[model samples]
Target chain A: MKRWLLALVLCLSPVFAQHPADSAFSHIYVSIEGGEQYPFGDLIDAVENSFYGGVGFRYAYLENIDGFILFDYSYFKPVPEGVKIYGAHQFSGKLGLDFKWKAIAPLAIGAGFVCDWVRGDYDEDKLDEISFSNDLGGTLTDNETEFGWFARLNLPLIRKETYKVGFNALWKELWTLPKRSETLSVGVYVERRIW
Target chain B: MKSFGKIVKSLVAFCSLASVGAFAAVDAEMEGMEVDQRDDGTFLVGSPTFFYDRILGAGGLHSESEMWSPEKLRQRMLLDRMSILPSWDVMEPSVWIKSGNELGDMIYRDFITAENRPTNRTPILEGGFRTPSFKGFWVTGRAFQDDHFTTSNFSYRKSFVDDEFAIFGENYPMFSTMYAGFGYSANSIDASFLAGEEYIWIFSESSRWIPIHYKPRLEARIDASNIEATVAYEDAEYQDKRKKEKGARKELNGSVYYRCGEACRRGMLQLSAGLAFRAVDDSGMVYTHLEEDRAFLPFVNLRFEPFNNLAMEAMFAVNERDWLVQDSLEFRPPVPRYTGVVVGVKNISGTRLNPLADGEEYFDGDTISLKADGQMNLVQGYTAFSDTMGNVGMGGRVSFWAEHGAETFDVDRYVEDDQMVYRHGDVERINSWIRGVTGELWISAWYREMFSFKALGGFERVDGNSSRFEVTPVEFFTSFTADWLLRKSFRISQSLRYRSDAQWNLRSVDPLVVKGDWYWDATFEQQFPAHGLYLTGTLLHIIGSETIETPNAAENRLRFICTVKKTF
Candidate 1:
């Protein structure tokens, strides 16, 4: 009778243990965010401060590290008084890793590499003037892809088992073919656990 | 040797394998944790004796309550949305210099002459400074000089909110901005004639936001000018006896716009409508004929994005002109009165009047008459598509333009009896109409970091009926451009353009036809990032057919241009 009881208990242990640990590991989440982004370096000379929105997916593989992928889109106008750029668009994608401190509750630091693309169309005649006079060359209208890297910090205000509300600040630099563009952004997000 | 495709595939496969390995570790850890916690707290909570003993039962119980309730989550989300508002201010200053030269026979139009084709060399110089201050205040000035003309202009603008007067909120002022400007221009037509004009203008505009989605703006401008001319004779001293005309023009314009979504975002729709009215008066000249004129302009524009990667835009406009002076002596050359012929002048009694006599009214067969009323209508549309990555795009545009007008002219007839006669009653009224359609396709790619290319092809067909003349239309046009970045601060660019043949009206029985030409240009640019200075050199029209036989076709010449700019 004792041997039968031990076998039964061992068999049922795996089933009961799956519920608590599943919440900590192998977790999937989706988030939506909106914020403002400011240009720096050469990018500031070409464009003004802009607003952005993004959607992201995160997978927590370890208790202290989470992997995430995101897509962001932003809009702004060209800088300087007479620049003709209007409704300029910037798009970027990122794959990154986040480091968390369980003792600090919901605070995490992240670093990542990104693929970025930017494009804007203005009056060709006016753009010619800007290009020739300002030395922007072919960057204004060409949909060029750039490789970049970024660092970010996040703090969750309300951390629940199923959902989290947080804000993040990030700084990024994209190495254009012949120039460098940089941006600093702060955003608020709402994340819901999916799996 | 490995292809780029193979390399990319290999990298992706490697990443997938690494991800699988990482996930496998998590799975193994999960399995271990499950085994360790197999018999955790189950037996004590399920025992019958523990349930009977209240103290043990209470000690064994474990509660599973959520860390945050739904109500608390909703409140935090609301607080996040309300606290996120960002604003910034920027100030930038820049200086630039542009210089170029032209060598050709250029066609110039005057108030009286239909065409003046002159073979000459022209050098141009332009420079400017701009300073944009905080709070939307700015000042700018520029000077331009060429072989035939010199001009300078200065402008200042100030924008502020009147907190004492609010339209929607205390921060939203009812009054918006004020601006003032002055300009001067002098044109020298060889050693025989010169013309000068000076103008001063002031403008003010106000905007108000209604509710949350609509904005309306009203603007007004008042301009005053003085125009005069002089003549120099070979034997006689130069004289400035021509009449001095003072003119004033007033314009009022307004616009309203509506937006249906967040600013500067996709999936948004925007619509705008605008209208303008202008009035002019310049009737103080004696030898020159002047008239009062007015115009009405209206337009509508719409933009919408029905899909994430596609956009469509359209615009329509109507313009009208009334009582415009077609030929003014103030802007034309004075006809010589020493030809031993007397021509009748309308609105003036004397047949032979010296133009060099100051404050004296003289007709000299120069008639100032009203031009025909003109109207125009234009419509345009565009559609564009871009990939999700935004690395490549294609777009197309179509436009239709139409104009209709008529003009009346008084001509001088010379009889075989050595007498020149002017007849006001023999008025010639000419009706004119022109309509055209243009279509264009453009594509660009920046697939690589070091090189990129852009191309545009256009086709246009224009047809017109003029009581006086006609010409053939442009049928096709194309341009291709490429850029190469050799380094971080240096670049080289090249472009080629081709245009189809076009006809020119020579005021003769048959028009002059010119064949199509191809033009090529190249440019090199360098930047000093440490000092915020940029320098560029360009060679234009380096290779092309140098000669074409149009009535006033300019001889093609290789031109060089250099520019220097500084930014702060």
Candidate 2:
């Protein structure tokens, strides 16, 4: 069975293999951006709007699809003032799918997914650990994996050279099930293509 | 702390690779290098970028400063033991794909929120694709990493007929939408089943053709979990205990809706049916019991428009073999067998379906509502947890422009017998009967905005479910909220709640006392135009009271907390 499985995987490899388009693509432009959160009153404040910065390559998949892979790190400090809670710093590698086919270019419909492997360290003194070894709720581990789906339409018609303008309607669901929560965001993004 | 950072970094790298694979192709068009040779292509490696942030003292770690100092300081020390904390980090090399709608693509981004508010400084990198291999069908796929979570999913959606191309298109528009997909977590923490608990689920849903007439949809899901054995020695006694458990659940739901006329857009009717099944196996010290549950529920929604935004929505459900409550009897050798047997294993059943403290019965109830909504082209919303701080939380808000309704349950009969006979082995029969019931009501309403800057307070009163041989209870819950964003970039939020205890029989109990909490955060941001870099800092605090209870007693508590964050 193992041999057969291996053979099958090898045979299917070429079928699912990805291709790099052969065409004359321009640098368009290179850009860097980042932001961060600052909690003033509560110890348990969140890492909302926290600062972040990264640089990446840009390409035109087609006249409609442009993609980029970016590397960035995010830190979430459980700023619950008097209480000490564990904080997490995440390193992420991201890929994006952008669809452009509408009256407005930046406002095209888009859907994509993301995966991240996270290593989290606990300030045991700061965060309380719930031990399932002594009971049934389960044990707290050091790593986290996230998977989710996002559907939205870009309304980035606000820029002349780049179409990263306008408001986007987003419907995304994220869960770490059993112990999971979901988020639904309806917001806008302003994008500019630098050359 | 260093190890944790390493783990997070590696996982991020793995996810980035997975995303890159999910993509069908990467196209880079650079005017200077392209077309040099048709067969040779250049793959430019991009620099690894980093987005950094620090949220010091989040999670209300300082709330109970006196008792929680050790833990609070430990968290701060992870970032260098300063009254203020800092988080340092870096990330993956970039592989930019032309972002667009295609088959098999990916998107990735890293972001940090200051003070952890909904106001996002989120960076998004996404990519994916869709391809039409055959004439009328296509497969669309993509992967992405962002502020909230990471996800990768695919959808095979195809229209039976392109309405625009139909020569004799129906006067009414008709379209079919269907999809089936499976997803797995790239982040272990997000995985459903871990360790002894294992869980994975596959689900699909679809709908077909409808205009103003009738529309229908069906959804289904299944999930499972498990466990194992061990040994222990205590007080010179060695004991061997082996245990295991497996549980699976399935659900199916279908609904249909139709419209009657113009005044009927406000006056439409719909019907829905659903079934849920659950099975369990337990082999643990706490309890060893196997249970099965099956339920079929059917309901309908009817609306009547006597005026403009004023309409009525009546809903009801019919339940069979429904388990309102489940009971089991168990005792140690020390207890009296007769007494234990007499009340041991007493299961109760009734027609009341709704569990709300309000005087509403899902068995037979309807709501009449009046609503007027206008679109100003400006939309906004907020997260429930955002207002509560991390100490406690709840999400999802169903706003009521206003609502009024009446409900009643029918009681055919009820019987009672001697309780002593079962435990003592004395057989005796007694006759008993209960009465049925009917009711009427009316209500006017006014409400406040949820998750908003406005007031958050509400009250409810109940007056029904009282009948011969029937259980009737009334309860109320009132809550208030306050949050403010100050001129100097300071934010403060607080909430308070009070509710009456739940009761089974016609009796009033002391109301549950819930104290409010005041949570605040201060922030500052600066941009370096010369270097194209940005920086920010924040301070946070939480103050409140909470109540805790044990089988023996209950006590209230006072708490205070503080934190800080800096990003560059």
Candidate 3:
């Protein structure tokens, strides 16, 4: 946990230390986003709808494009289902490119790679009934680290000189744990220029 | 062999001396010039490059192609800008030599049998020259030979002759281009089983373009090719019967492409469509009763960007191919010899004494034919977002693909005894179809000049005609890569990959399931920009199990490769 926190701090420190407004290569900003995620594939039977919140730092180095790195966390309360997964938590890090377009308002389109780490608590009775041995001669675990890709589009609803409000949609595939998982989400965000 | 060695040695010595003199001259010329004004003319002459590789290990029972082999030596020289001639604008010449020992066997397996042929050493040599555009005309020629030294059981050798000439209009209102080429390849293989084939091909293509809107262009292209092959085989019976076969194939394709908007920019649109036709004719004693086959196919593609931040693309195609008999065989018995006793017996019996005069009869040995028709479609959309500084960008894409195909095969079986016996009643026709869908999502992030990350995940569901089940098993794949440029001249990258278990049926056989596995790889690279030198070292399959599922059990092994490249 300490190492992850340190890495996060190191990733964000350069943005605060540099003066991006005067430099042609840097435009620093922070954003907060929230959205509802719908689980599909194997997860549909174990988990229901969930909401996620994320914070990210973005730097624009080109005329209409910016690169960003973000971290998101989601919590899900499992529904009464066949396998009885009590609850699930997921954490992911996303790195991607976004292109900003100015029509009547600003529209930002983005796509990137995602790395996910997921853990769930299951009922002992359910685990005893469903667990099976893997090729490595070990029982299946409730925790897994998976990798996936995602694409998203964002539309700014309100814009000001230093702040903006927007709505965005995202689609992602999480392939792991002997099955494939898909997620689609729509949410709103608020962005503020830091430099 | 000695004379060849002398020629190669002389060429290498001459190139080394020429490069040294050219570099010295360039350095002398740059003595009084500013750094920004200096140009390295040494590259115009030529550069000598050498490469070497060694295989570490390989896994899988059928992984003969992946087995380790030592590449003892590879040398190449690239020369450009030899425009001293009056009519030629520029000339480029290249020569390459490679020698390696292949310590693996070539395995051929069918539903019924498998053969493993061992290879010992292989050597390849090639030389080519290309001419720049002179009066809108360009030409190139190349000759190459590849020799494989195998065990006493099999022998294989190949040689190639190729040439091409093309012309294009540079300043015309409409772009016009045409090219024609011919290739000849000879291969001889002496194996326990006797088979030999020779192939020859010729091809041509022509294209014209018209500008419709500002920078919007439409182009049309037509391409045609003809191929001919001759084959001979001898059976391993008491009296080896030799069979000769001949085949001819032809193809014609045409397409039109249109492009509008800025193709390299954020918003662009391009569309293309094409049609193709093919025909194959076979005639010989081996296929005495077969007929010619023909097919036609069509395809289209579209790419559009309705907004600056969003792009969408789609493609659809129907592919059809002529019915092809994979490997067919026929047998014939020799006519019997005449004897005086047979004549006396025929006279007593009041029958003709012409047992030796009977005509030869043909029997089907093993017959296999295949026909296929398939269609595939794909659609994708992508959008991106970024901050004002453009240093950080995030993007995502969603894509869907589907394909449907039908394949049919005709098979026949026969028996061979003192003479040849044909099994006319043991013929079967098999037909099958496959349908599958795939969906994928991709996300990527880039940090300015330092690090970048990308993730991709997808799912595939396939179904086919099989007795085991109609629904094929689902499979999933995901991978991620992280690259960090620690400095301007050095970089390191790592990747991880995972795939889900998959099951599929083959040739009306039982379903086969392959257990999924994980893989990891890492690479390190360094560059010397001033000298045009780059070096890379890669480690593959560093964290995966040594065993994976194949038609036959295969073992995965770790390997490493290091490469050095230089442009003089």
Candidate 4:
């Protein structure tokens, strides 16, 4: 947990330090977020809960809308015992639009697309020691990726001229094999406005 | 004034985006992967290399690629088909990278269920850059490959090669290509020369995939003033380690054409002429052998519009060994201001669809003839009409075609090797006449430059000895497509389509049926005009069953592709 937090902070420190707003826009926000993802349905038996940290770029899209792009990284452990690999490293990229409906001033609803790329964290020198035919984590040893759709709610807790604090929760369904995999993620972010 | 210019730019981009007819994101990593984008035909992809693509209204049993034209002179001759996929065409001035994979890999699902484990999904990788022109001179290089369908008959293909048979990875994909070259561009003058190595699998007349390796394929092209010319030399090596057979083929092919200039194109009569030729030399046990090791053809294309609403177009190609002629005449009677109608008659008569192709294919101790006796002729009459009122529009077309001596396959028997099935066959023609009727309808609506929606449907019925034809095409298909641009920065394109079942008659003992179903493909793109950067993600085959469309091809599974490109 400590290492994750430190990495998250280090990954986002430079953005907060440089609040350069040269380009003109009604709104622009650079943010750093940390979140926990929970597997749903059959996926719960596949992977355990994991924490993720990511950076985001938000820009004004329309009078009542905003667009955001996100990049996140997480480490997931297999729920099944006796898996061949230690854990899986996953990188997530998302592109979404937030609808800041006047009816819900500070709260916005959004839907977008998500892409996840994953590879098992294992030792390469021991490739000969691995057998993949029926193993749980064996397939992850090779790079695996999936694309899906996500819907999220964005709530701004504290808003200011140059900074803001917000909470975001999203549900994503991955188009995985046999059946689609679903997950819920909740995170809080600190954002600074940049052009 | 600056803000107004920005709005105009946005409108231009939006209009251009919506004009693409929703080619859908059927795999942007490769050209011609848009087989799903074709609805007027029976299209089946055996692999990235092999497919049976026949337009229903095209009025013949042979696939479109099996026929030759001057327009396809630059296309790679893959066995009996002229294909542009796995093409070597250069790109616009841009730096780009694309990556994608077949979607159904187990991922986490592998941990839970041990039974019926899914096959490992394969990936596609592509990256290249064409440098911005440096005073009319530029350089470009590319390395690309698709490992998607290689897993279907992995072991069988792998045993034919000593090593991976690809630039990278152990998967013996259907094709792996890498090339680099330089080009010069100026007003009315463009020239380029490229050399590269490629590994490709060509599907033979006997339903076998023959692997060919081009160690250094060289191509040079120039388009200056009103003339365009191209030439290529290939040094291909063939090997089937399983059978301990090895062969080599050296070939040279090219074309030179002259078209009407800009000023002449404005006149009522326009003309274009070209000559295409191929010369080959083979040694050892080559799978296919060309007749007399040489072919030379000269072709001409003409368009004559003597008056308004009436036009005639014709293209004719002839050589010592073959001759082909295609001509179309159309008339547009006066109609309402907002409505249009065109009635046309088209005819195609050809001694051989592809005269430059090899004459014979050697497979499993059987000599398979690639050419059929006699000639084929097709005639079609079509009438199309369209009207627009306000923001809504509708159009429809109906065509009836008849053909004599349509090309087909005569299968003696079938052979099974590993997971793949092969056939012993000779190309033959149906002497009796075959007929088909096709109808298509479409409706569309648009709102300024922000949104557009189009729905299209088509049906075709074929008659007369249809069972003997190599493929019985789909009967009907429908598609719903839409495009939306939000705030001039984000674009969304989506399509949902369904096609009826199609069948292949002679590839196996039991006819192979390609069950058809609904498929959803979508593409999302983010454009930063100021930064000249574009990021796009596309998903394909969302709702369709993962079924192989051809006899020995792999499943056409759901896949996703993402690209990041920056135009200069």
**Higher-DockQ candidate of 2 and 3:** 2
Worst 10 residues of 1 chain A by lDDT: A1-10
* Candidate 2: true interface contacts recovered: 0.00
In model 2, which runs have C-alpha deviations exceeding 4 angstroms?
Answer: A1-141, A144-195, B1-242, B245-263, B266-296, B305-313, B319-350, B354-452, B459-568
Model 4: runs farther than 4 Å from truth? Answer: A1-25, A41-45, A102-105, A129-134, A156-161, A186-188, B1-29
lDDT of 2 by residue, B1-568 (tens): 4474354335323322332101111111111111110111111111001101111111100111111111121111110111111111000111222211111111111112212121111112223333322332333332222211001110011121122211111111111112222222232211111111111111100001111100111122121121111111111111111112222222221222222334435333322222222222212221111122222333333444454323333333344432222122222223332221111111222232221101111111121111111100101111111123222222222111110111111222222222100011111111122211111111111112111221222222223233211112212223233332222122223222222332211111222222222322222222223332222222222121222211011121221111111221
Best by lDDT: 4
Worst 10 residues of 3 chain B by lDDT: B341-350
Candidate that scores best on DockQ = 4
TM-score of 3: 0.34
Residues A1-195 of candidate 4 have per-residue lDDT tens digits of 212222232233222223234332466789999989999997888899999999999988656667788999999888888777788898999988788878888899997778888888877886642356557666777778887778899999998888899999999887777888889999999899985
For B414-470, candidate 3 gives per-residue lDDT tens digits of 333332122322111223433344445545555665555555566655445533321
**Residue B47 error for model 1, in Å?**
99
RMSD of each: 32.2, 28.1, 30.2, 8.4
Per-model chain B TM-scores are 0.44, 0.27, 0.40, 0.94
Residue A79 lDDT in model 3?
Answer: 47
Worst 10 residues of 2 chain B by lDDT: B198-207
Pick by TM-score: 2 or 3, better one:
3
Clashes of 4: 0
